[model samples]
Target: MRGPASLQGRLSLWLTLGAVLLWAVAAAWTAVHLRHEMDEVFDSALEEAGQRLLPLAVRDIIGREEDDSPDQGVATLREHDEYFTYVVRDAEGQVLLRSHRADLGVFPPFSGIGFADTATHRVYSDAALRGTITISVAEPLAHRWDVAREALIGLALPLTLIVPASLFGVWAAVRAAMAPIRRFRAGIEARGGGDLSPIPAEGLPSEFQPNARAVNLLLDRLRRALEAERSFTANSAHELRTPVAGALAQVQRLIVEAPDEDTRSRARQVEAALQRLARLSEKLMQLARAEGGRLQAETPVDIAPILRILVADMGRDAGGRLEVSLPDAAVIAPIDPDAFAILARNLIENAMRHGAQDATVRVSLSPDGVLRVVNAGPVVPPEQLARVSRPFERGATDAQGSGLGLAIVEAIATGTDGRLELTSPATGRADGFEAKFATNRIETK
Candidate 1:
């Protein structure tokens, strides 16, 4: 059979089992020893009774002044169950005196002095007056068995209470001893992939301290590596931004100055390529910001104004294709304004870039801090929709842009303990795409 699955249960079970086994062994040994001692005491009692009764029986026979051939029974003043009985006999094997309840059949032929065992009784015989007068004391074996049984029960009764108490004590001690490990596990689980702070290894037992130290060391290495990567990304993007913008401006100038149609068209293509590079670099910087440190503000603030400004800028560029709706009351939240803006911008841009060119994009923020951006477009397949949020993964649409939009929004949501969900077909719409962000960690009022 399988033992307990958990460490605490196994420890308590085995300890309790060991204690019960030891108790059982001790009790058995004690009972055997007790029975031996009891036998010695009972035998001594029988011997003493025979010796003391022999003289008194001789006196009674002599004082009777009657030459008796048949047995003479001693009279009893009260009625009781006599466990021990005795008989006085002559050398000729004639019973001269007997106890009130003595059965002559139980007394065997006396061979010599000391203890003897009959089938039904333990007989002790003694003689006086040169072996002519003899007395035998017989005690029933059943009476001895009864006494032994009661003594054995006395040794066992306390176990009923002791067993449960021992189990409880074992469980309590094991739980207390494992408390530090439990705390360590809770600390690790609470990190949830964002927080890489090392877990403290204090108060752990010697055997478990090494494991705790190893886990903390691993977390430290991961934290350093991630920080370095984010720093590299931010640096590369920041360095590329100025040159890419300058290149795009030069290409635009060349497109206007080119002498032939083919040359002008080629310059226009170069300008588009440079513009793509600049946007890609910008997306990379946003991704770095989204993946780095804290994303929440020190206190809650109304983020409605930031949303309005972004919608106006994006709408003006899109030729009035963007539609926005903001709550009348404050959309109070702890999310940092910059992070929220980046997230909102990415969602809005992704919808515009992927949706039909002339279709309207709907952006709205509910009173409870849920941002929904829906665009009229072809429904994305289930399998393709699943991976669209990954870096560098874009839809099959021919629109040109960096694919870090959804990825950035996802990172910000994860860091801020919010959720971002995308649907291929927008809820309550026949054919569209929807991105919903829930910052439930906000004040609704």
Candidate 2:
């Protein structure tokens, strides 16, 4: 069978069907019970009428024996023929008395017992007169049949009205019960994509409160996800713009000055700047993948060794302009090796680009499990300190660097359950960058 089109219609159909089935059962039971009771009432009344008529039958039987003829008794009984049958017989089995219509050949059957059937209630009775005489009474079943027919007719009209009335009541109740669900659906449809607020539960019934709350909770999560995506996009566009513009400017210079050797050397320098821009673009894509929840970094990693490798690589890349200071001890945390390398490389690379030339970059893992990357850079204003953590918002004196470097590091740290912090030097001389990871050791390392 085809299903109902909506919840309200389905619920209404089910309730009406159930009510009809129950009503059929109960109404059938009631009609049968009423017929049975009517039969009982009629049977009792017949028995009572038979009681009053019996003594008259016995007197006529006794009178006939004394008269030696039934002619006189028969004449007296001639007046009552509509509701009775009377016959009398002697001890010799010959007819002694009879009514005007009573035939000697036909007689009512008698069980000879003076009471009704113990199992059924068809009353029977016998009374003895003068030792040898007998009188009997019985109620015919035909009277009870007539009473049942009349009782059924009396109830037919009432049952007809009850069925339709009950069905309408059932439909009304089902509609009222499902009204809240309809309202909730309408509320959802009215909202546009940009409207991510939760559905209100005010004035709703208790049964629908949980449903509204659950839908609102799902909307709340979706809003957060959309907000994070918007942030990633805005930062990506801002960070990518400068490098693209710089590459365009260098290309224009190369076209104009290619014939001169001195101008060619300058073009080569511009080409190097273009290479740095390409690398920055690639790093931004990686950061987007990590932040957008597309990257899965579930693995055991030896973070200390990863950091040592990154420090060594950055030291080589920096030439003699940067020096590395490291702790003698090692520390570990669970992470993807590629992700850890990216994080360490970005943090150290950002420090080297921003700090003073020939400055010492301290790389240390505390015994209590804090990884620190401190470089001696110009102090950042307290008001501007928090802006550096966000993408595309670089500090003063760091104009040549891509703003995405710290943003990528922060994404990695957040994904791995670590914290990134930037602090001003105690004497306000240099800026210090620190990241702390929850500590562990790699079983394989």
Candidate 3:
């Protein structure tokens, strides 16, 4: 049979089996000892009966007025069960007297002296009157066997009761010992996302503490690695922005001062290249901030005002192509203002860049802090819709911009325990794209 699968079950089974085996050995030893002691006691009684009755039988035989037959049965005063019986024999080996229950066939020919065993009885013989008379006492061996059997049964019955109790005790002890392992498993399962805290190993057994320590060491290493990566990304982006902005300014000056139209055209191209570099650097910084999990605010802030300012700033150059809708009440949410502005700006910029020429871009904020941005464009393919939200995964759109916009929005939303939903062919539209940031970390007032 297959053994138990759990550690507790296996330990309990083995311990209980060991206990039962020990009990069985003890019971067997006790039975053997009891049998030897019983034999000694019964033999002593047989010898005593033969020695005491020898002299009495000699006197009775001498006092007889007439001679008896070869075998004479002695009379008894009462009818009762007899466990011990005796016979009196003369010098010629003829039985002169016998007890009422005594059988002549059971006693053997007069052996010299001391105890002897027959087929069904234990016989002890003794002589008196200088070997003229001898008496033999016999006891049934079946009686001794019956007593030993009863004593062994008494020793075996209690083990049947103790087996179950012993098994239960072993199970309880094993389960108690495994409690620390269970707690450690739960601690590991509860960690997710950015939770890199070390699991405590206090009270755990020595054998299991090494596993816990290994896990904690791995988590510490991962935490340091992530911190280093974010720091590098943010620092690199911040350093490049200043130089890129200065270059863009110098290129703009060159474009105006150029005497030839061809020179002006080349300077304009350089300006565009520098501007794109600056935008890419800015996106990298935002990505670093989102990944750092610093998007939460100490108190609720009115995100509606931030959205209004962002839309107004972007709408100036939109040439009447932007449309906005906002709830009359303030949309209070628990999110960093800078992060919210970054998230809002990415949605607006993505829509403006991808929407059809002169098509109106619609931006709406629900009272519950659901921000939706929809733009007129070719419906994104089923396979590409989900992929577009990842970094550098631009769809079939021919827009000129960095592809990190939607990825930054997703990271910020996720960090603050919010959700982002993207749809191709925006709700109730035939050909459009939509980005929905449902910031559930909000408390509208």
Best-matching candidate per lDDT: 1
lDDT of 3 by residue, 292-334 (tens): 8768888889999999999999989999989999888998999
Q: What's each prediction's TM-score?
A: 0.82, 0.44, 0.60
Error in Å for residue 404 of model 1: 2.1
Instruction: Name the 10 consecutive residues with the lowest summed lDDT in model 3.
Output: 188-197
Q: Per-residue lDDT of 1-445 in model 2, one digit per residue for the tens?
A: 9968976667767776777677667767877988777656655654565556556666655554464664333555345523333444443445544555544343433446345442323544444454244333333455555566666666556657766776677668867876666677788875433456877667677888988999899888987887678567658856886867777676767857689888777777777777677667767776764465422246554456676777777777777655444445544456677877777777777777777666776666554446667777667777777788788778887347778888887776666556677776523343554433433343332
Q: Could you arrange the candidates by lDDT from highest to lowest?
A: 1, 3, 2
How would you encode candidate 1's per-residue C-alpha lDDT over 20-95 as one tens digit per residue? 9899999999999999999999999999898889989988887776556558899999999898899999898889
Per-residue error (Å), model 3, residue 91: 35
TM-score for candidate 2: 0.44
- Least well predicted 10-residue stretch by lDDT in candidate 2: 436-445
TM-score of 3: 0.60
Off by over 4 Å in 3: 1-195, 203-205
Following a full C-alpha superposition, what root-mean-square deviation does model 2 have from the true structure? 17.1
